[model samples]
Target: MIWHHLFQPFIEFGFMRRALVVCLALSVSTTALGVFLLLRRMSLMGDALSHAILPGVAVGYLLSGMSLLAMTLGGFIAGIAVALTAGLVSRRTPLREDASFAGFYLGSLALGVTLVSLRGSSVDLLHLLFGSILAVDNDAALFVCGVASLTLLSLALCYRGLVSEAFDSAFLEVNARRLPSLLHGLFLALLVLNLVASFQVLGTLMAVGVMMLPAVAARCWVRTLPGLLLLAALGGALSAWLGLSLSWSAGLPAGPAIVLTASLLFFISVLCGTRSRLADGLRAFFN
Candidate 1:
């Protein structure tokens, strides 16, 4: 019965298998990046970037008419632009990074929504807002895998700089000054790339939700950065499986199912985390 319920869907349907693959691929890069962003106190920054991509997606669709390549590229470029601009504004002016990101993304979101509404049908809008993971084809899979691999490798190479930037900018010294925004830009590029990749599989909202929930849950369990990354990845993988299984059996939408699964994991961690958060809170209250 268990095999019939779980294994049968995967074995019987190509789309089911592909959705699983997409989720697994997303876990690696998004979990790590999500942890990093949270460390930098830029968790909300991710939300801003996700919304900012809508304009680009709309423009791409308008120009190329539902071409994945065009929309992905357009979204990617827009994401990078928003990141860089936010970074620049934070550095050059009184506006804080989060505030700057907020300003930029809201504007972009408005523009994107307007543009998309001008041309596409409700079906197209639904696809853009929530993604159609079950419809992911071989080519989209390859693109996602490729982006995941690149994000992992690139972050690995720049690990030192990233760590320094996050925790000890004062210690960054010569090399950090030399590159200035190079490493930061690379990281933003990965963020954008992952957004684009996940945008295809889970849509903008669920993509960001999946990444953030696991990272936050993992944070509750572990204090160390590496531990957070590892646990988040595992949590993401499990959420994906649970989400896929629920979607297949219950007939829920794939994006919401996956995100809800992640949310469940997050809440569980908050209540029974390794850190004993709930227990500590109860004890404190009783005392």
Candidate 2:
């Protein structure tokens, strides 16, 4: 009975099966990248970067009239621009990185909203902001898979540099193959790419949750950086499974349902992970 109820929806419906594949793939990329972001003390940057893509998406829609490829490409470029500009401003000016990120993201978001409003109905705007995952077609799914593959490959290549820069900037400057700035650019590129892909599953506004919630939940239970990434991947998988189950039964929006499940796991980890014994075991496994 338990197995039947749990697996029946997926077995009966192609959409559910596709959602599972995409969700699992998304979970891997976002959660793994999220580990780096958290360790680098840039957790909040996810929120800013996620919103920063809005203007680009809006411009793409305006120029191409809602072509998925156009909007995604535009958003990716815009996100990179915002990240680079913010980094530059923080370096040259008295402002901190967080402040600059906030300033740019706010402006970008306002511009995006205005542009979206000019020619689109509230429904169109809502779809962009909140997403419509059930409507995701094979083309969007293919794009997401491609982005996920690239993100993982890039992260693997930059692993040592990312860790070194995250823990010790001076040491990283001496050791990293490319300058830390180049690594930073690569990291932001991955961030924007994930956000664009996530927009298909969770909308621009909510996609950040997928990256954030699982990463944070894992942190509650782990001490080592590698342990954090592994546990975060686990948390993301759990969220995808539980969230899909809930959405199937309740007729809820799949994106929010997934995020909410992740949030619940975060709370559970916080409550149960005081001593981090489970995390210690995980660290040992990796070691």
Q: How many clashing pairs does model 1 include? A: 0
Please give, for residues 1-287, the per-residue lDDT of candidate 1 as tens digits. Answer: 77876788989999999889989989988989999899888898778889889899999999999898999989998998888888899999999998999999999988987898899988888888899999999989999999989989998998878888888666675545756367677888899889988989888777898879999999888988878889999999999988898898899998999999999999888888987488679888999
> How does model 1 fare in lDDT?
0.88
Candidate 1 is scored at a TM of 0.95
The C-alpha lDDT values of all candidates are 0.88, 0.88
Per residue, candidate 2 scores C-alpha lDDT tens digits across 109-170 of 89999999999999989888888776777988898888889998998898988888888878
In candidate 2, the residue pairs with backbone N, CA or C atoms under 3 Å apart (3 or more residues apart, or in different chains) clash, namely: none
Q: What TM-score against the true fold does each predicted structure earn?
A: 0.95, 0.92
Off by over 4 Å in 2: 175-178, 274-287
- Candidate 1 lDDT score at position 70: 97
Candidate whose lDDT is highest? 1
